[model samples]
Target: MAKEKSVYVCSNCGQESPKWIGKCPGCGEWNTYVEEIIRKESGPKKVSTGMESVKTRPITLNEIEAADEPRIDMYDEELNRVLGGGLVQGSLVLIGGEPGIGKSTLVLQTVLRIPEKRILYVSGEESARQLKLRADRLGSASGECLIVCETSLEQIYVHIKNTRPDLVIIDSIQTISTEILESSPGSVAQVRECSASILRFAKESHTPVILIGHINKEGSIAGPKVLEHIVDAVLQFEGDQHYMYRILRSIKNRFGSTAELGIYEMRQDGLRQVNNPSELLLSQDHEGMSGVAIASAIEALGLF
Candidate 1:
């Protein structure tokens, strides 16, 4: 029989507590403690993550072949530029945005446009038929793109191993759950465990995993703050739904600088990438436009 342990965790800082309290001792947040159940094993029980063990063996630097890492062209100029010249293999990317913010549209349009890579899109929020309908409206039902409606994290890995897709995209990470964890889905423990599992697999198989995440009312990524630390890159999609343009900004990137940004225009036929965003932002009709000025940054040399 497995033993159970109960602990209160602060949602803000992920600080563990033995008893319930009005304020969190770690982050000083009030009434943020939530009880979480953890199953403890006797005699050092073996842990099974369902799809197979994610454990990896350490390798020496000399063992690896030194060469420039290969990248996959996404076929979109704006996306390529923001991703630091295409997506890198074995990298985990997190795309977070508000509800109805075109996060799904951007990803579906991208995978459908790229026919070179075998893509597996796992949707926990929508059915496969719904995804197909959306694809039809996007004007491309490429045979290269496959959709599976599943919420079980373990089953997702099973399909991945069988299909052996070169690229994998999860519609929303919040909906996926793992049986290895005792807490409910979307909980702090579940989110961290699931993300860690996916990260390990991506590194071991040399495949890229793109996760769609939800944002809170505070305009920050939902769930534990540690989720952002586990991913290789965190890309934020922001813009008002009423606006015609959307911006994709890189908040954190391990392989490249975070100053890169991508712009897209939402249209009836899916998203259209803005090749030169500067031209669009700069007004062409300068006549009768008061207070419109163009300024350029100048660097000056100074003695150290």
Candidate 2:
């Protein structure tokens, strides 16, 4: 067994320090350092995953196949448009937003509409009963959606292997932890390690994983900067809690354009996709009003 020692690590950049400091030298953020336990082993320890062993080898550019990657339709036109038509296979997508901003509702409602695919919805923040209640309110529940309230990373992989789902969803990355690391869940080290492991699993098994993450005080994803770099795409769910309209903006997308956006309206029955903004943005009362001029402009893969 290896000996353990505690070290201060910055939550913003994953920088290590011998002791606590007021500001993070790596990211220049204040009060972002947290102590984490490290094992003094001879070399790095490998994370055990349920994915099949498929060794990768480098190949010449000419030998590689140049075919269009397959995509999974989310069934929501707004989400599909923002994801550059549809979600790509083997892609790891990270969705971040403020709490109570309808992140879970949007994902649950969308997945429920896809009855053909088998989806594994794992939640660490909410219980299975809570998710079921939300699903009941959302109304469709047509797909073969399995819900599990778990936080252990190893257990999650076990569930993945047993279920072999077509799509996997992690409610929030902050709450999931792995036994490989002694750091608590939501720590910088845990978030980085878990996300990297999930990304590897997604690629190796050719299964898409959607990770919902929390935002920090600065409004960025509550994890190290490398977390964003590990995923294939980063999407931001933005809107005020008091408002009915919400926006989904693509911050980074390796397979498609990042300028696209998705809009949804929050209602009592669930989230309703807004296919056309003209109907909501422009009202009959606004017609023939002074200082009102309608013009055509392209934004978020649509004409407005």
Best by lDDT: 2
Off by over 4 Å in 2: 41-54, 285-291, 294-304
List clash counts for every candidate, in order: 0, 0
The local lDDT score (0 to 100) that residue 230 gets in candidate 1 is: 89
Clashing pairs in 2: none
RMSD of each: 7.1, 6.0
Quick one: how many clashes does candidate 2 have? Answer: 0
State TM-scores per candidate: 0.86, 0.88
User: What TM-score number comes out for model 1?
Assistant: 0.86
- Global lDDT scores for all candidate models: 0.88, 0.90
Task: Give the residue spans of candidate 1 off by over 4 A.
Answer: 22-25, 43-66, 287-304
What digit string (tens of lDDT, one per residue) describes model 1 on residues 1-54? Answer: 678999888776788889999998777879878888998766865777677755
| Residue 191 in model 2: lDDT | 96
